[model samples]
Target: MSGETVITRFAPSPTGRLHLGHAASAIRAHDYARERGGRFVLRIEDIDGTRSRPEFVAGILEDLAWLGLRWDLLVFQSERLAKYQAALETLKARGLVYPCFCTRAEIAASASAPQGDAAPVYPGICRDLTVEEVTARAHLAHCWRLDMAKAVAITGALAWHDAIAGAVVADPLAQGDVVLARKDAPASYHLAVTLDDAAQGVTDVVRGVDLFAATDVHRVLQALLGLPVPSYHHHPLVVDAAGRRLAKRDGALSLAEMREGGEDGATLAARVRGGDRLATSW
Candidate 1:
């Protein structure tokens, strides 16, 4: 991701209201790029149709603007299905993708796996399936999974310079096989994000440390798609007084709730900047 100017993005899923954590990310992305005379790209990660709301998206934009954090023309992940599909086809042609027909119960039966914020580690039961066999099984309900074995064979010991995490190595074993597409969403986070970052010519990625592990999966996909590798910065996550990471379920810490109690822009800004040192950290 070499360029005369740097480009960064704050891709937020509009599943809930913009809270302190959201403000921190938006401010950091906006300020970092602006500080270096670069571009700040805004991408709405609304692939999850069940939870993504238009009202929430609008409110997010409103909150960011209220904080005086402006971004470039907005891009929505929901609008880029064909691009993701084409990339999926490329992976398939390279024999780096297969269909997995495992239900929640069946996958659970493999092991009582440890959670990493998202679902448990997906067992590679179907990772070695042949394309024809996978195709036949695809007729039934199943999502597409990336063949990490083939992917790692193509790119060995992948590593990148993280702006904050220093040298980051891509761990193939921990990442294992990942889903590219699901029944509900057209594209998974791995596929959609990798395509969007490349398309936007992003020079660096700045997000919470929560996503540090996923970078390995993205790196492998980047190699498979022949896209440029951008520098990453996994900053500290914003946690509450209880030390729990802020989430959508933490409605009490929302900007809207604080605003309802007579907080203005400057007040919100101070709290956000002070709450987690969030602006500069992310």
Candidate 2:
């Protein structure tokens, strides 16, 4: 890699308290930035207004501080709607995105295979909507979905560098049409994250391995939008003793709960850095 200063970010949705999994991810991102004398950013993914809460956002800040992980800059997705809108309009103008009106049940019924780890691959029911049909459905609440085929056609043969996997070809077709914007939220995670990473000059994306597959979609978006693709480092997830992935539902493992129980922040941070054998359960 070049000797340029690396920039990484720990972006978490403020829907729940910071759990052990979140702590581990943050520690990894922060350490990566610090090791290279670079910058670490904290991004609040609060696009889902219905689920996101101010209290949760406050808890996230307090937890990150207690964990001894400092960020060089902080950004909130809720504050960047206009940027996402402009990107969406650009895609629409290029005929790379269309409105999707399918509900959860409708999509589930349309899916051909058993739902995999990620959200069921969106069947392209709305991809072929005619201008008049789209005009009629324009009044109804709908989500803007990227036409993966057209996008791939526009930017043929894409790839991204990964620290673990090396150069990997991006296969966004597996994801089908992904929602870029929703009726309730101005931007979906795919659109918001790709744009934010570019805007913040994130050179390295360090996150859970679960998101490795999603990188394909993001890479395609980067190519379509003319944004730079960052190198990725997909780390293993923190799991409980039973090997189950840590989740927000495990309230006892939340950083706030640990702090309230008189746990040392540095000790917890060290444990997370050391590996999966945490002193506390997960």
Give lDDT per model, in order. 0.81, 0.89
lDDT tens digits by residue: candidate 1, 1-282:
244688999998999887777777777777789999999999999989999999989988888777777887699998888998898888888877888888877777785666655666788887777768877886788888887877898888889878866887779668778899987788899899999999998888988888888999999888878899988888887876667777756533577766666667666676666663433222
> What is candidate 2's lDDT per residue for 127-201, written digit by digit as tens?
888989999988899999998888888889988888998889888898888889987999988999999999999
How high is the lDDT of residue 262 in model 1?
69
Candidate 1 segments exceeding 4 Å error: 1-3, 112-118, 130-136, 274-282
Clashes of 2: 0
Best by lDDT: 2
| Ten contiguous residues minimizing lDDT sum, candidate 1 | 273-282
Look at candidate 2 and tell me the lDDT of residue 43. Answer: 98
RMSD of each candidate relative to the true structure? 3.0, 1.4
